[model samples]
Target: MSVTGPAKPNFAASGRRVFDIEIEALRAVVARIDGDFSRACTLLLATRGRVVCVGMGKSGHVARKIAATFASTGTPAFFVHPGEAAHGDLGMITDADTVLALSNSGETDELLMLLPVLARQGNVLVAMTGRPDSTLAREAAVHLDVSVPAEACPLDLAPTSSTTAALAMGDALAVALLEARGFTAEDFARSHPAGSLGRRLLLHIRDVMHGGDSVPTVPADATLGEALVEMSRKRLGMTAVVDGERHLLGLFTDGDLRRTLDDDGIDVRATPIATLMTKTPRTISEDALAIEAAQLMEAHKINALVVVDGKRRVVGALNIHDLLRARVV
Candidate 1:
C-alpha cells in the first residue's frame, strides 16, 4: 500500500481569486456612485461638529480607519463602537454631529438600535450598507450603496468584499471633503508634526543653517590660506568669498582646495581666493524648506550651499551634516 498525503493548496491562485472578487466588487460600487456621494460629501463638509463613525466587528475596524483618515485630512471625525454608543458612549455624540454608520447586512442589531436615538436627536445619519432596502438604509438621511456581487469568501459569508467597499467609500468621502475644504500640505504637516513629511515641509533653511558670524566667510581679497582658516574655524567644509559690502563674490570649497593643491603653480599662502573660487556658486534663500536644500545639494552633486539674499549677500551656510542633524535629509 502506498502512503498518501493531502495535496498542497494553490495559495497563490486562491489569493488571486480573492483579489479578482474584491476588485470586481469595487467596480460595482464605483458604478453605483451618483449624487448620493455628493450629498454625503456636502453633509460631511457642512457638519458643524465632528463626524461620528459607528459600526461593529470588521466594519468597526474600517470605520475607525475612516475616522482617522478624515481627522488627518482636515475633517473632524472619530470612531464610536455601536455597542458602546448604546451605553454611556452615546454621550460622545451631539445634535451637531453627523453619524456615519457601516453595516454590510444593513441589519447589524447594535447599529440599528442607535438609529432611533440619533433620529430623535435630529442627527444626520449616513448609512453605508449592501442592502438598500434594509431598515438602516430606510431610516438614514443619506444612503451610500456599497453592495457587492459576492463575498471573496468561499462561503460568501465573510465581510471581505463588503468591508472593502465600505472602506473605499469612506476614503472617497474623506478625500472629497478634503478637496472641497482646500486642505493643504502645510495643514497636513500640522496634523503630522512628527512625521517625515512634516519635517520636510515645516522645517525652513533658516532653522538649520549657521547664520550671522557662525557662517564661514572670507573677503574676496583674502588668500586661499585665509579662506582655509575660516573653513577650519567654522568647520563647514567651505568658505564664502564675499566683497566688502558682504555681497557673495564666489565660493571656495574643500573640492576647490584639492584642485588647487594638485596645481603646483598655485600656493595656498600666495594665491588670491577669488582667482580659484567658483563664481556663481549655487545658493538658496533662507525661507526655502530644508528639504529643498537637500534636493539642491543632491541635484548639483555638491555637499554645501551658501544661503544668500536678493543682493547676493551671504546670510548663512549649511552642509549635509546640518540637514542630517535636523532629520530633514
Candidate 2:
C-alpha cells in the first residue's frame, strides 16, 4: 500500500479569498452611507465636550483606536469600556459629551446596558453596527450602517470585515471634523510633539547649530594651519572662511583638505585659507527649519552647513550629526 501525505493547505489562496470578501463587504457598505453619516458629523462637529467611545470585546479595541485618532486630530475623545461602565467608569461620561458606541450585532448586552442612561442624560448617541434593526441601532440618534455582506471568516463567526468598516468609518468622521475645524499640519504637530513631524516643523537651525563663540570660523587671510586649529577646537568637521566685516567668504571642510592633500597642494603653514576655501558655499538662515537644512545637505551631497544671518554673516555652523541628534535626520 502506498502512503500519501495530507493535501497541502493553499495559504495564499486562503488569504486572497479573505481579501475578496472584505473588499466586497466594503463596497456594499459604501452604498449604505446616507443622511445618517451627515448627522453623525454634525453631532461630532457641534460637540462642545469630549467624544466618549464605548464598546465591548473587539469593537472596544476599534473604539479605543477611534478615540485616539479623534483626540490626535483636534477633537477631544476618550474610550470607556462598557463592562467597566456598568461599575464606576460610567462616571467618566456626562450629558455634555457625545457617546459613540460600536457593536457588530447591535445587541451587545454590555453596550446596550448604557443606552437607557445615555438617553436619560440626553447625550447624543452614535452607533456603528451591522444590524440596523437591533436594539443599540434603534436607540442611536445617528445610526451608521457598518453592516457587511459576510464575515471574511469561512464560518462567518469573526469580526474581520465588520471591524474594518467601523475603523474606516471612524477615520471618515475624524477627517471630516479635522477639515471642518481647519486643522493644519502645524496644529497637528502640536499634538505630536515627540514625533518626527513635530521635530521637523518645530526645530529651527538656530536650535541645533553651534552659535556665538563656539562657531568654527577662520578669517579669509588665516593660514591653513590656523583653520585646522579652529576646526579641531570647534569639532564641526569644517570651518567657515569669513571676511573682515564678519560676512561669510567661503567654507573649507575635511573633504576639501583631503582632496587638496591628494593633489600635493599648498603648505598648511603658508597658504591662506582664501586660496583653498570653497567660495560661495551653501548656506542657510538661522530661521530656516532644521529639516530644510537636512534637505540642502542631502541635495548638495555635503555634510556640514554654515548658518548665516541677514547679511550673510556666519551666525552658526552644524553638520549631519547635529541633525541626527535633533532627530531631524
Candidate 3:
C-alpha cells in the first residue's frame, strides 16, 4: 500500500508571512535611527571627494543602488566591488574620498583585508554591518548598525530584511544629503538629461515650435478658404490669424471649421477667416518650457497653440504631436 504524502503548504500564505515580517523589520530599523545616523550624514557631507561604496554578495546589489542614488541626488559617488578592489580596483579610491563598506556579518574577509590600505590612503571609512563590535566596524571611523531581528527567509540564512533595511537607510542618507545641499529638481534633471523630467525642464517651446515657413498663418482679412488652404498645406491642423503687423488676432482650427460647417448660415469659402476664428485663443510664449506648452494644451482641450514673442507677435506654432515627438508630452 502506498503511503499518503503530507499536504503542500500554501505558497501565497508563506509569501504574505515573509512580507509582513520584513515590513515590521523595516519599521524597527527606521525607529532605531539616532545620533549615529546624523554623524554618518555629517561625515559624508564633509568629505571633498566622491563616496566609494563597497560590498559583497546581496549587499553588493544594495550598495550599487545606494551609490547611484547618491550620485543622482547631487552627491558624488560610485560603487566599487570589494573583491575587485583587492585586485587593484582600489586604485579608484583617493586620499580625499570616503569609503562606505557594507557587510551584514561585519567581518567580511575581503572588506576587512582592504580596510588598512584604505585607511592608510587617508580615506575615511564608514562601515555598515549587523555587528557593531566586529573587527570591520572597530576599524572604521563610523559604524552604522543595520542589524535586523531576523531574516525573512524561513531558513533564517538568506539576506532579506537586512538588505531591505540597508537599502532604506541608504535612501534616507541620499535624500537628507540632497536637502542639505539644496539640490533642486533642476540639478537632478541635469544629471538625467535623457529622461522625461530633463526634457520637461530643459526644453523650451522655441526649441520645438515650428517657425518661419512651417508656421501656418494667414492675414486677418484672408478668406476662410485661404485659411483652410494654409492649414491643410502646413498640416498643423490650425492657422494663426494675424494682423498686418503679424501680431496675433485669433486662431482658426479644424474644430472651428467643423462648427462653422454645422452652422448653415456660414459659408467657409466666402466668410473672412477672422470672423470665424477663435478670439483670445490659448497661447504660449516662445520662452515658455515645453512642459508649460503641454499644460496649456491639456487645459484648453486643444491640440495646437500659437507661440508668440515678448511683443505678442506670432513667432511659431505647435501641436500636441510636436510635444510627443520631442518626448516632452
Q: Which has the greatest TM-score?
A: 3
lDDT of 2 by residue, 217-299 (tens): 98978999999999999999999998887799999999998987876657889988899899989999999999999999999
lDDT at position 327, candidate 1: 95
In terms of lDDT, the poorest run of 10 residues in model 1 is 259-268
What is the full ranking by lDDT, best candidate first?
1, 2, 3
Candidate 2 lDDT = 0.92
- Put down candidate 1 lDDT per residue, 248-300, tens digits, no spaces: 98999999889889997887798899899999899999999999999999999
Error of 2 at 156 (Å): 1.6
The lDDT for every candidate, in the order shown, is 0.94, 0.92, 0.92
Q: TM-scores for all candidates? A: 0.93, 0.93, 0.95
Query: What ranges in model 2 sit over 4 Å off?
Result: 1-5, 243-245, 262-265
lDDT measured at residue 207 in model 2 versus the true structure, 0 to 100: 92
Q: What clash pairs does model 3 have?
A: none
- TM match of model 3 to true structure: 0.95
Query: Cα deviation in Å at residue 226, candidate 2?
Result: 0.5
